[model samples]
Target: MIPTRIAVIQGDPRARVDLAVGALAPRLISRDAARAHIALAAAGMILLGGDDVHVDVSVGAGCLLEIEDVGGTIAYRADGRRSSWTMEVHVAEGATLLWRGLPFVATDGADVERRTTLHLATGATAVIRETLVLGRHGESGGRLASSFVAGDADGPLLVEQLDLDGLAPEPGVLGAHRVLDSVIALGFEPETTRGDLVLEHSGAIARHLGAETHTSRLDRVWDEWVKRARQRTASHVDKPANEAAVGGN
Candidate 1:
């Protein structure tokens, strides 16, 4: 599978970012000394049949990166064919990453597997937003296997996996709901305490489930968590200056 790569590092004049095109095109939308914004646009039709896609991203120490998705993706049915998508992310010490992703819909007769993993160093921060739709309008959806794994320098933060098939609808799995929206913040505490699960490590995940995507209540959670995540980035950014001042004295 051809892979898409994006990386950012601290530089003298500004932060330098690198990008390579594969299934998705990574375009630099905006940048400053503190953070760089990149938009991921689909290069062509995706996840039709027997397709595999991979994305790799890295944020260097003392730098930040923000990613935006241009559009959502829908998996079209391909006569019992299977597809897969995987993403890997790494954040160095004193770095931050923010990603806002669109919906990933699995249509009827489609089969797809997706996995995402995150690795964080000491004092690293990350906030992620994801929306998973089971099917299109009035459709029973297809087979989906989704996994999320995250860890820090000390230990693992979160590990979750779900297997949903359109043929079965039960009480424990989705339970008549078609949408699952989640907002995750790592290396910081969320200001909102209610209706969210705090991880054993340093992080929180706020999730919402509903029949429809428009009525989902995760927008407020996303805003609050993003605010808290940005606060942590500020402290990481200022540490080097403070250390230099101490060394001079």
Candidate 2:
């Protein structure tokens, strides 16, 4: 397990960071009075059989955190075994989380479980981009079971599960598609919803399932969604009630 934590108070000039690195290394790329940019790099071979990777993220009130992946992740063959990856995120009121993820490829014979859990306070927002690729050059991919859950103090916002184990090519599933790309915005809907499915709650997800990564053509949507999220976070005005009392801290 690789533990990474960062926070910024209402009037703080810098972000406080804590870390205990394992298979992944987290580094602060840049920071300021209102925002922080960080990056995650792979330390060594990962997603092998019996490997369990966990990530925990927290954004303080009135702060903004942006995370970028240095490269992509490739899950190799797991010889009748399995690997797991989990991420848990908490966004405080008036804060925002933006995660820019690269592609994740599962090679032949690979079996992996991926899970994400998100918690958003009132008025908080988050934007995420992810691309899942089935196989490498010329082979059929392995099995992947992915689950996601997101909610706030009021109630549940989103919940979904995708099981590709022996069901990748099913009618409702991938079905001859090797790539599944998505750009998701939570806590608020973006400016556009063209050809995208709107969530039941105050959120939306733009997805593209195609034969190849480039064929998805979701980069433009990602750019627009990210811009919208940035604008919202930049102008958010709410802060904790005690912010005035602890402004000097």
Candidate 3:
């Protein structure tokens, strides 16, 4: 079966939703205060062989958009075919986008490919989170190829690719880890702690690799980055009001 496809666009200074479209079980769940939440409603046993899902999102100048998943997505074992999921995002100047992705589990014999591409204009910001788990307890996982590319009008901000197999330990890739959690923040420079991968560009990536119990390694970094991003956005939003107040006085 073909995977789900979803697209959303937010425009105007008020951050109103200008367009929204979805197919194959992914739909907009709610909207409030310039924020929209999308949910994946795929029924039991998702992302089987030959499934292909695509999501496209666009945020207009000065708009804000948030996306989330209702629950974890499980990729069942494949029968010699590959399943894939891809997301493409575009953020206009001064726009902000936050994607809270839930866990993706790959069971034994599963084959999956996941990819994301982000394009940002000057002053645009984006925050994205991902968690990949290899198999459930007591079972070795399958094969996965995960890749991400992000850039702005100026230049490329990040490009990364990982090919992993749960049963084998690569020399330099994931080593012996079974879980990988990551958070990517772009368009702003925030203070980071040790272990945070600070990029040359105005962004940082924090990742955790280990058993599921080690997932907390990314919690502190993710929380701090999210807080900083929200604060920055709030300041930008309040700047005009403050300037107007001063002018009136």
Candidate 4:
């Protein structure tokens, strides 16, 4: 059996020490470097032709980490085997991470499964976004199974799952076209005025890309709907104990 792999390349600190604070602390990171890191990591994984892929990322406190892929990840048609990608991120307190992975293009007959789990400690902030493009231009194949989970110490903060099978592009699913994207922002609440600004920015992007827009307060979405949903019912109530038994706690 061939082994799966994950590559990580973090940036160096580039902050000056405050005379009062004593030691220098990393404040911000370069987005260019971040994109390059993911690009190289994914490129290496693609070359390996493995049966599975897993990536885990951790950012220490007071460090700013930004990650982006060079371009879309294309998963070719798989044989009988399945390909999987997993990302686990831990953003410590007083840190920021702008982690966004580009659109993943799955060609015909491809069975790719992807999951992302983010753990945000108090005072940490992160903005994460992912886009998926179903089936390439031609030579149609298989569906993409994706799951996203973001949470803190208490429980899940957000969860988005996708099981797009046997479904082509339509008005509701992936819009009139065949591309869909979602974003999540966690940690400190944005001010009312700033909240409006964020919405405006998202609207501009939606208009530019010709994609449908959906935005909600993460808290309200989780409390009113997510917490009461079908999968969520089992997730928050029953899974933690099971996870603890498995040493996942």
Candidate 4 per-residue lDDT over residues 1-249, each given as its tens digit: 232222223233222211110011111222221121122223243412244655556655554554555556777767756677666778776555555556676667677888888888776666665666666664443677888777777666666687764355434554544455544556643333223323322111111122221322232322232222212123212321111111010
Cα-based RMSD of the predictions, in order?
Answer: 6.3, 5.3, 6.7, 14.3
The CA lDDT at 70 in model 3 is 69
lDDT of 3 by residue, 126-240 (tens): 8888998888877789998999999998889999998888888578877777888998999998677788889998999888888883555766776787777767567433433
lDDT of 4 at 81: 61
Candidate 4 residue runs with Cα over 4 Å from true position = 1-41, 45-50, 139-141, 166-172, 190-249
lDDT of model 2 at position 171:
79
Question: If ranked by lDDT, best first, what sequence of candidates would result?
Answer: 1, 2, 3, 4
Q: What C-alpha lDDT, on a 0 to 100 scale, does residue 197 get in candidate 4?
A: 22
How many clashes (backbone N, Cα, C below 3 Å) per candidate? 0, 0, 0, 4
TM-score of each prediction: 0.92, 0.89, 0.84, 0.60
TM-score of 2: 0.89
The 10-residue segment of model 1 with minimum total lDDT is 240-249
Stretches of candidate 2 off by over 4 Å are 4-11, 166-168, 235-249
Name every residue pair that clashes in candidate 2.
none
Off by over 4 Å in 1: 235-249
lDDT of 4 at 20: 13
Query: Which residue pairs in candidate 4 collide?
Result: 108-140, 108-141, 109-141, 109-142
